[model samples]
Target: MGKNFTYLLGMLITIIIGTILYFNLCSDCIAGSSNNEVEQVVTEQATAPEPEPTSYPFAIANGDFDYSAEDNFNFDLSSANLRLPVSEKVDFGIYKLKDYLAENAGKVINITGLYSSKEANNTAFPNLGLARANDVKNYLVKLGIPSSQTNTFGQLKDELLPLDGVLLGPVNFNLADKAEDESETIAALLEKIKTNPLIVYFETGEASINLSAEQRQKVADISQYLDKVDGAKCLVIGHTDNTGSRATNISLAKDRADFVKSYLVRNGILENTIESSSKGPDSPIATNDTEEGRALNRRVEVTLN
Candidate 1:
């Protein structure tokens, strides 16, 4: 009986060990299969293709509208009047142009002066075209429009039309982006001052203020600028037409400079910040032979520093 019991106990122990071994092996195999499945999922995810990115349209600087010169009116070159638009009733063209520019301050204006004839008897075409364009630019600047918003082009007639006189093409107005670079900004500012010069004209041989609306506007612009920029200085340079002797013109130029300086001071500009000088007829911008050219030559330039 003892022998039989010992044999049965040994077999039972062997069976228990076998059952444990089988369970352990099955668990390892199942774990390995699960690991393989996880790796396959990770590999698939790593090799999957990414979605494409969306693209957008490029933006335009001056908005989407197409702007051109067709929006503005042209001036009549037949009239000899060069004064700023007022009660003169000279022509509605300038007034219309001014109104359009005023309403559309964001738009850039291009004033092109066109001459019908290039005869020597006619006013120097270059000077005439320049003067007319300058006049329009000055008027706009006086009305508080920025000088950078305007440009001038002069076109003398290449071919004369029958009975056609000096005619100004329609002032071109278009949408333009603001100047981006420092150089462009400086250039625009310089052009602004040059086009709208503060010319304190005098009597034939005197140093009195011309007392015109144009002069008043210059004074106002200068005063406004001075007020806006503290510690700013201006150099008031006087000039003369070549109508008199050199010594006489130099003296007249000085007198004119003094008057301009006094005028600025009177208008609340700092006296110390203003410097005055004279160029006389030595720096005449226009020809001395013609009355109109001489008129243009006699002027004052206010340079801001």
Candidate 2:
């Protein structure tokens, strides 16, 4: 009986040990499952973020679009972008948009828009308003294209609507939805002149050169500036106040342009690079009846030819 009692105690101890081992093994399995669940949650959190969208500042929308910037990353909008629409509403000559494009060595420009005519000589067919959208297109591609960054657009027609005074003022200065994010060499030089024309002018009207002088320097500076351009030729146009008679004004305007051209030639500028003209009192910048207007009128202007 003692032996049997001892055997029973041993059996009980063995059962207890087996039960404890089973419980420990079950606990380890549960811990492993919990660890795997935590790892999966961390991995899921890491990979589920939002992505950003791509954008183009001067994005081409319409089918008729062409743009050029030597290094597009550093492009100026003047010659860095071009767009022209294929529409009958466009005029070939009056708007002079083609001339403007040619002058800038084929600036990248968009030719599709409600155009107005500022043609020096009105063409046989005039546009509805003063703008010539189609002429700009054909001129860019057909006539004298320096670059290939021009295009036409339909969506922009909606965005640039209703030409009111205040809105028109800001958009006139080659303004874009966003600033160009690149550095274009030609556009850079053009922009410098557009923004700060004084850097190329003398004080008022003296037969001297001053890169630092304002107003008159635009003429002399242009002569020096042409060298930096690839294939630049300019029309040096002269004008005068109505204070003088038409004949006298015309003569004075011619003299003024000649004087400028002579100075440029003296300074080693090629003579063929510039063409001279005299508008006299006909194309007064302001109402010449006023002193300020007269002064403004008695000046020379350089147009891209």
Candidate 3:
């Protein structure tokens, strides 16, 4: 029995030692494995690729025209000129836009040109934004889109990021509502024109005129009206202050009216359709006793007949 007990005890001690050694070796192995895992994680993190730069896409869309995920045009800082990107997709998209507009009648395009106040305005337009939009409109017109079907204006944008000194897709295209009945449209246009007639104010002895975007649009609308309504006439009436003699004032007023007529004729309106006259100092919309009133008096009133 004692010998049996001694053998059993020796087996117990051997089993204990083996357990201890195994645990110690396993701990070391576990530690080594953990260290290797950490190293692998670090290596992977270091070898990972950097994220790509952000891309600004240029696109155009309308009712029938699908939005194309392609760059069409780019512009330099403070520039109104269009810089075409090196992509055939642009041409395809433009042709598609043109086709869509041609197929869809009575629909008009409104082009909004975005500009930053930080940019310089060097164009003859009222602002860089309008000039940019007008350039785009002109391009579309050259592409066979009717000038009457496209209208342009400017919008101020505070957030315009330029990539390498170039602005991508600075213009936006929106389709205006389809025209209603022809007579209804004409009546509405006439009401608007008469209620808010384009009154171009002039300085003393100044012949050059600069029109605002709204005024320019009015001129376009008038041109469109004259094109549609046969025998319609555009009357340009000039008024003056009572500063000079009646005859001299009438002559000055006549010259102003003639200048306005020329301007209208230059903008697609037929010269023969326009009639110019001078009211001299007889028709003053304001008091001629003050400078401000006199300034208001030196004006040309455009009306549709």
Candidate 4:
């Protein structure tokens, strides 16, 4: 009986040892598998590629017309100057926009040019923003768009991000139909001209004349008015400061008046529609005592009849 009991006890001990060894080996294998999976996930996460930067395309859109391009007009930092991009796509889009405008006679485009306070105003305008807007307007006008159908203004922005010191798409366009009465619009324009007559200043001995952006805009408005009203005449009067003899001053004033008349004729106005005369030293808007006043007096005043 003692020998049988010993044999059963030894068999039971051996069975328990085998069971423990099998469980330990399985645990090691499971741990190794889990580690391999974690390493693969870490590698994938570390080697992932970064996303590219977002791009903003320039666009011009109206009710049913929409055009977009990768590039548009660009300007240098702190400059009122801009140049159109030399891309076929951009040119095609602009031509399309022009055609759309021509089809809609009542549609007027308002160009709002953006500028930062940090930019310097080097143009002969009230601000850099306005100068930039006018530049764009002139470009459109040269492309056969009526200056009367387009208006320009400036907007001040707190911040602007530029690429390589160039501001892309610095202007925004808004096309709106003119809703005011025609007669009333003409009356308002005439009143504005009366209140703020277009004046051209001449240097001491400079014969060649260069008009500022503001002056050019005034000329454009005047041209539009003349086209609208029949038999309306433009009067260009020249005046001079009291510097030389009375005869010499009178002759200089007359020359200046003729010069202005020629300028108007060159800009699409008929010579017969313009009347030029010299006031000499007789009419002085400013005192002839100081250089500043004299400079102001040496000008040609343009008015409409």
lDDT of 3 by residue, 1-305 (tens): 99999999999999999999999999999999999999999999999986442234546555456666557566788998877643577666666767777877677777788888999865545567767776676667667776656667789885887877888777777777555676688788888888888889999768787787788667756755664566788889999999979999999999999998887654435577799999999999999999999999999999898
Q: What tens digits encode model 4's per-residue C-alpha lDDT throughout 48-129?
A: 9754322235577776878889865667777866765446776677678789888988887777778878887665455566
> Any runs in candidate 2 off by more than 4 Å, and if so which?
1-183, 191-211, 214-225, 228-230
TM-score of each: 0.36, 0.33, 0.52, 0.58
Model 3 score (lDDT) = 0.77
Q: Residue 183 deviation, candidate 4, in Å?
A: 4.9
Poorly placed runs, candidate 3 (over 4 Å): 1-58, 61-64, 67-96, 120-131, 151-155, 163-166, 174-186, 206-236, 242-251, 254-282, 286-295, 303-305
* Superposed model 1: Cα runs more than 4 Å off: 1-191
Better of 3 and 4 by TM-score: 4
- Comparing 2 with 4 on lDDT, the higher-scoring candidate is 4
Name the candidate, 1 or 3, with the larger TM-score value.
3
Q: Tell how far residue 237 is off in model 1, in angstroms.
A: 1.1
lDDT scores of the candidates, listed in order: 0.56, 0.46, 0.77, 0.76
Candidate 1 structure quality by residue, lDDT tens digits, 97-178: 4565566756565655444454331221133444345455555565555555665555565442322342323223334543
TM accuracy, model 1? 0.36
Report the candidate with higher lDDT, 1 versus 3: 3
Candidate 3: which pairs clash? none
Most lDDT-accurate candidate:
3
Greater-TM-score candidate between 2 and 3:
3
Clash pairs for candidate 4:
none
Which is the better candidate, 3 or 4, if ranked by lDDT?
Answer: 3
Residue 49 displacement in candidate 1 (angstroms): 92
Off by over 4 Å in 4: 1-57, 84-86, 198-237, 250-278, 285-296, 300-305
